[model samples]
Target chain A: MLTGAETEVVLLSFQVAGWSVLVSVVPGILLGWLFARWHNPARALLQGLVMLPLVLPPVVTGYVLLWLLGRSGPLGSAWHSVTGGHIAYTTAACVIAAAIVGFPLMVEGIRLSVLGVDRRLEDVSRSLGRGRGATFLRVTLPLSLPGVVAGAVLSFARALGEFGATIVIAGNIEGQTRTIPVAVYTLLNAPGGEPGVMRLAGVSVAIALVALLVAFWLGARQRRRVSA
Target chain B: MIEMRTRHSVRGFTLDVHFESAGPVLGIFGASGSGKTTLLHCVAGLLKPRDARISVNTRMVCNRPGGTWVPPERRKCALVTQEPLLFPHLSTRGNLAYASGAKDALESDSGWKIVDVLRLKPLLDRNTASLSGGEKQRVALGRALLSKPEMLLLDEPTSSLDAELARDVLSLLLQVKLELKVPMLFVTHKAGELMALADDCVVLESGKVISQGAPVNVLSKPRAIGVANLVGVDNLLRLEVLRHDEAGGVTLLAMGADVALAAPLCASAPGKTVSVGLYADEVMLCLENPAGISARNALACDVTRISEMGHEVLVELKIGLQSLRARLTPSAAHELGLAQGTHVVALIKTSAIHMLG
Candidate 1:
């Protein structure tokens, strides 16, 4: 009943989500800041590309990642030799897939928060002898924290639900690679697995509800602060 | 010696403003859409004109051709716009502290402290958005002062407030001018308020300087929109010169009205004509056409139009071959029963007459 298999999958979900957010946070914040402040040559193109993960089928995205990271594939072969390891069927592949999908959501949230801050306040800061860096640290970042938090939380939730990409590349190894969605699919596929289905469904619902509530709380706080 | 030279083209309008002056308080007097705010933006280094050079006390904020430029924060000048723009996230006290820098041990003595300066100690914990317009502007003023800026750019700071609130904001500004050595440029179209506050004025018209000088000099020009419409210059009378005294002073006959100047007229001769200006406030309205009064040049007239303007009512009278404007209290008008087509006497003292070109 208390098998290590279920625990490992749950633990694996956390690991993958953690790694995905860690690798993407910097690029996400920078891209967000860029989108909020500067207009570049590829701004529209970049915006479109960032949203592609949401619009495209998850299976197609997972296949593309598989092709890009397969042992015989161009980057995969080079990465394998350099790191003395294979990327396919590994936990790292799950993180890469999750991050690839979750990046845009995080960036968009941070960008919206930054855009909401008053430019006039920045001017006021400049007149007060604070340099651009100091002003960003003191005023801009503080104001944008709620949005950043919301974005990160949303990204975590997306990573938690990631299924197609993980199965295609990382494979459904029971104790190593199988996460919540993969486990749910397997339970539904087996005969007389109604008890397992009911148990896993309960856990999934709890996690989704908590993540949604947290996102809602953050959004409400941001609205009150910004609108005021 | 501060100067700004710029050319910024925006669709139908082109802002080409250039001026250099050393007045303690200079009012950028103009009508709406006259490029007053644009000029202030350029000065504040918020918007760099296409090709321009702006210098304030040897600090070169912009030079376009050679690519010399400084950002707004480095400009060390604060702009107080029609809206206070206090940070909504901060309290009134926090908003004041939002721009406060350079806190030394002797902070309370430098005339800018969170507690002592704004008188916002009570509203310290209250959200800035909840405060009154005057309170917010006061907070904004306090915020700007805490920055210890070299010059203050106030763009219609009290325009958003009611009369009582505007008066309160103005009183605070007056206090700043007297206390600190900070120079200020206030943009407004109200000449009466400018008269009550500004030390000097630059009259701008459709993005050009029609006149710039001492407040009295610039406000007295006959062709000046500054004096004509805004100040309600009562007797902007155009007529022939009647006499010239041996001393520098000369006298002119304006609209069949005798006017004498303390200074020599531009071209004082028998037939030489010039315009003379006198404020309606200066031209007293009298009930009886009393003779031998200390007031010179009393004209028997009829009150034509009476309209309310601020605290005073402007009484337009068709006086001595010309219609003239005169300001009187509503109580005074009520007491006198000032109405249309009522015969009355207008009094203009020789001292109150402003010789104009």
Candidate 2:
């Protein structure tokens, strides 16, 4: 039977993307809400920092990651101290590197949505005897969930395509850190390149379309419900 | 009871309003940016005012100098702003239940569920998005009621509605007051709204409560001159000297039409243009120019503009040099078919003209 290497690569891509998206949501929402509600002196600076990975060339971002988590960096050493030098060249590193690149997408989407939310609604909620936390949870958060969903999908797509950063930070290893993009890159550099590239490209396209459709469907449903 | 004495400076506007309300329904009347809603917010514990003192049913919710300020949720004070602002995410029933009093919030026997008191069981599952303005207000009212607030602070609850819708909302408010027996601090500038719902009136101008009393007396008296003007008083004219009557009442005349003015009017020289405001309610509309009538003041006039204001009509009359407004039943307007340049009579007694400084 012919090997289904494309399926394996696509599955690994989804795994990394899923982990990246899931890990970043709580922080993304928190920061988005903060940026929306407050007028801090550092808002511009903080926003710039969030978008840095997006602006930096993915290869540059990847190299920076390699330098920061290459066994001797402060975070790398602490992680190594606990996990016995297993921080880099792992699926976990791929997820983390992809998440860092996707953080800006998550933050900006949720931030714009949060800003668009009607704050008067929250005040009315307070007048209706809802406390601050309860009002945010029941009214504010639900109202902004559509943006969160959109952000999550974009983050997942970006994470799935993260090649340069993932390779530099995690060092592609078969069936572990080698996501679809990295596997395709590796294959294209080898003798039987076209077949692997074509196969992985098809898998990538399918996965991206499915994820986007599902994300938009969920977001639209939630928004329609909110409006309804 | 709804009592507030506060001074809160917000941006450039300074809100300094002090008033007390124990009436089943109380209204704060003011123009736009006149600080009525700020006063309401202070009483609701939504805004903490400097040097403020607030009490609701013997419970002091705020004492600013003493650093005692109950948070809004803890205060059990509900507010309905210009918009009904019913929770869009919730159904009508869900919104009402959202504010229902916790067991800890109740000290007495008033623990109303969504269905029993508001009669909202039928609307429980119905989405609030589709409710009409009046229905949404009713739901908002129900939500506020179910909260078991000691006092309700309503800021222009019906201001968003048309006359018919406003009447419906006001009647519901009256019903809520009657059924719940809870005091309400309602704030609005609409004269009709205040008259419909409020037993006591607190009139504010430039963030100060200049007049506060029973609605009719405060509204009709000379001390409440500014409020009367703000309420669109029809007449504020010059008084001319007329022959003093044998009864020792100085017969001061006003307008091209003769009407006696009560004497010893503040800053009154016989020739002084003493501004006496006459509310439209004080004016009488007659179908004919009768030869003899018990009404002391009668003047033949032509109709200017007949504005249909709800069930009633506001007939503006051009009598000699003055224009007078008369609030008449639509039936009267329909009976006369009063329109532009139609002959009519405005018989306003001297005693009916409320004098002011």
Q: Mind giving the per-residue lDDT tens digits that candidate 2 earns over B1-357?
A: 767678889988888777777787888877778888888777766677778888888788899877788887778888777787877766666676676453332233453432345455566678888777777877777777767777788988888988688877787777777777878888887765666678899888778887888665565555554665665545555556554454644455555655344433243455655445566877877778777676666678889888886777988887667677888888878887788888877777766765544
Clashing pairs in 1: A126-B73
Alpha-carbon runs more than 4 Å astray in model 1: A1-4, A72-78, B105-108, B112-126, B222-301, B306-315, B318-339, B343-357
What's the number of clashes in each of the models?
1, 0
Model 2, residue A2: C-alpha shift (Å)? 8.6
Error of 1 at A54 (Å): 1.8
Q: How accurate is candidate 2 locally (lDDT)?
A: 0.76
Score each candidate by Cα lDDT: 0.76, 0.76
Worst 10 residues of 1 chain A by lDDT: A1-10
Candidate 1's displacement at residue A65, Å, is 2.9
Off by over 4 Å in 2: A213-228, B48-53, B58-60, B63-66, B100-121, B221-314, B318-342, B345-357
